[model samples]
Target: MKKNYYYIAILAFVFVFSSCKKMLEEEAENFVSPSQFYKNEAQCVAALNGCHNPLTSIFNQGLILANEGVTDLAFLNNQNNETRFELSPANPGMGKGLWTSAYQGIMYCNAAIQGIKGAPIAENRKPALIAEAVVLRALYYYVLTSTFGDVPFYTDDVANLATLEKVNALGRMSASDTRKFLIAELKAYVDALPKLRTSEVPNNRISSSMANVLIAKLAMWEKDYGTALAALNEVKTIYGALAQYPLEDTYFRNKNKPESIFEVQYTWSVSGLKKTTQVACYFTPPRTANTSTYNGINIPELGDKANPFTSVSPSAYFMSLYHVWDPRRNIILAYTYNGQNFTRPQSGNGTGKPWMGAKFWCPGMDNLADGNNQKVFRYADVLLLMAECANELDDVALAMSSINEVKRRASQASSASINLELTSYPGKVEFFREVREERARELMGEYGRKWDLVRWGIWYESIMNTVANEFVDIKQNVRPYHEYYPIPDNEILRSDGKLHNNAYK
Candidate 1:
């Protein structure tokens, strides 16, 4: 695999889209000051692209060995199992790398929001631009707080040595307060912002509806079911129909289907660096990583030859949660070749046979520039959010219908979904639990699991149980302090512990 030296051009905001690599691999000499760029409209918007770029990184390919799609190590690996990463804080394993990488993205979003707001863009363009910056920043904070407990929050720029002190004074903010602030901030802009972004939209950028779906998502994750329902209802009113084509045809195995509320756009090629979505390059099969021979099987440039990418396989315990007869069961996972035989192992580890949880499909024969948009928040999630909200109010019928709707579409059925019901014992709490577990299975491998657990209040318990056997592994050890990430060491040392006032500390 190649190193990420080329990222110096995007070091500030691109933290969210690409994977983690050593600073040694990046040329320190190439670092550019913000003052040198982000001077005007075009430059500011370019800066926004850098902010959104990291979305792809954190979701699919940032920390290679620690697949974000495969485990919520922050909770699952460290909370329930006898995992070492949870026991050892300084362990050079994947969990710490993921922890560090996610925070780096938060830092990038913070910098972009601050830089764009302070830039000299015209007043006429400033509100929308500021809105975009805030939306992205809120997104960064959302992902950060969801993964690590008390991530230091920043709404300003901290560029120089003396300025970095502000960060040290902060500790973890209450997750509840953090969620409320972010959700409100995003809701305020979704309908008011422009439908289409002036810069990039179909390729590595976000739009108003994208913000809408995300707000809905943020609401759902925060367990504000009523608010989440209201938010997604707004989205459905504006952009929910899939009449142009069957929802399933556009969704399921095909990437960038019309129902996509928001996505990470990619234009990859085997040649010199392009504004390609690095995600596909990082997760496709090893055979597709360097070749251009297989586009016919998947959706984008279906038969084009392509290179293969490596990834951690899905957990065996989770895999058993599926219903064998479901069509999407096969479509969502590649346990057997051609949907029947066991997948051959890409690595020989006991559970390490190659198994792809189908979400993104790279065209085999096409170059990296196949233009496949990675759907970030699709209608399906909105539907689920709505259903969850319905369940919260004991509207079992609506909840069942909503889940069934998503399932039916995944199964390519034209009529509403069938066999929907929550058979759990009594109360809404039990039903809510069932809804969440179902989502875990239905929405696996999409970087939403950890947040789901946290929002449901099982994050602490899960991590504690997971790391019970790893008493020596500091990384696996779940400290009450860990509910919020530690303030970055640099920021703490600089702040003299005064500015933000140690949140988790």
Candidate 2:
């Protein structure tokens, strides 16, 4: 298998698209024009790779911090100034990187789809390649609309100056329209993608199974449980019979594990800033020696001797949810420094938060570029979503069985004390509550909590309660407008008033 070094050039292409107005409009003197570039299969693949580049940026520390920080699981370091509910359109931490990077990636997908159609590639190969680009475009738009509510949505590539002007003058689409378009596109293109990656780099590319998982996710967002269930059942039909796809504890650090349906690939050797993800730098605690003792107990050496900025920490509320025997607590919270474990201090280091877990810590890398592949969709998520869908569909037996699958894995990894049974819960509501809490425990720091809360329509209510009790300083800022992030001020300006802010405020 070849290492994914091809993404290095893709990173450069992302920068080019980020700086230029229309990808086709500004041709560098040394670079071939878009019309002349996609002459063969290799060239078309490169173009598609460029579309995948922005995902690295979208999942990086900046966006993860914003997403997780706003949820109950974690909080940004105090110096960042943007609290859970205190964000604004002009706030520096209000996810501009996510907004811009997602759109840039979408534009690349649009261009790649257009370019591939004109390429001289084999007829058998064109549909798969084009399907790959289309699924990715839907993924990017999913992130955008979920975060900002209504956004400027388009599918056409800006092939010339006039088309670029026309696109720039377009207004934001209704959220309903955006969701409908994405559902239609995914349904259309999913069949063309391969069932699994056949390249030397196995999980680096999209597949039909991954697309189905994404479709399930989008359907769940729209509260369309029937569609979501059908999509997930399709995934089950393909992967459920395979013994390799069972739930496991080691999927976090292990790349392309059977549980992973789709992941953003990252490699240290990819040679550019986008080559690696910065999750370790933001989540790992400072690498101080074990000299300091808390309550006369020695605090173990915290992180590796790397520049882990330690700018994000798990909330006390989040830590309190886990029982001592829960396997995920140790994986999600860094109470132990080095090898020696210690209790969290009551209050000291900038609001006195507990450190993030070893799941994101990279032992050998001591710099910003830690090569951790971010999991976008995984099998455990599919199980959990199935549980939720089954519960909503009034199938208590299926819901309990699905939720127990995840719990069974957790219990095997830890102790029997953490094990759950269908009899443990009193009723359906309690079972559903456990399911939600289980998601928090299992998927913390993976950037799913805020969206989960938002889709449940409890984001504002839950954050308001958390702020009023644990963080009174930010309590007053909690409002309905905080549900969806404000559209970036720059995007609004670029649209020349065609784009408007989210309507909550």
Candidate lDDT (C-alpha), each: 0.52, 0.69
> How much is the lDDT of residue 323 in candidate 1?
61
TM-score of each: 0.68, 0.85
Error of 1 at 455 (Å): 2.0
Compared with the true structure, model 1 gives a TM-score of 0.68
Clashing pairs in 2: none
Model 1, position 313, has a per-residue lDDT of 40
lDDT of 2 by residue, 1-505 (tens): 0123234334445555343321211222223456667877867776776677678778766667656765766665454556645677777364688887887788789888998998998988998899989899988988887788778888877665556667678888877688877887888888887765322124357878778887887888888899889888877766663224433434345677766677776666434433577777777655444333432344343223456664565666687778777767767776664556544434555345566776776645535767777776777777889999999998888788888877777766675455544555457787777888888887776667878888888887777656446655557556777778887777778778887775634
> Model 1: how far is 62 from its true place, Å?
4.8
Off by over 4 Å in 1: 1-40, 62-87, 92-122, 159-162, 195-204, 220-222, 241-255, 274-317, 337-354, 357-361, 365-375, 413-430, 459-505
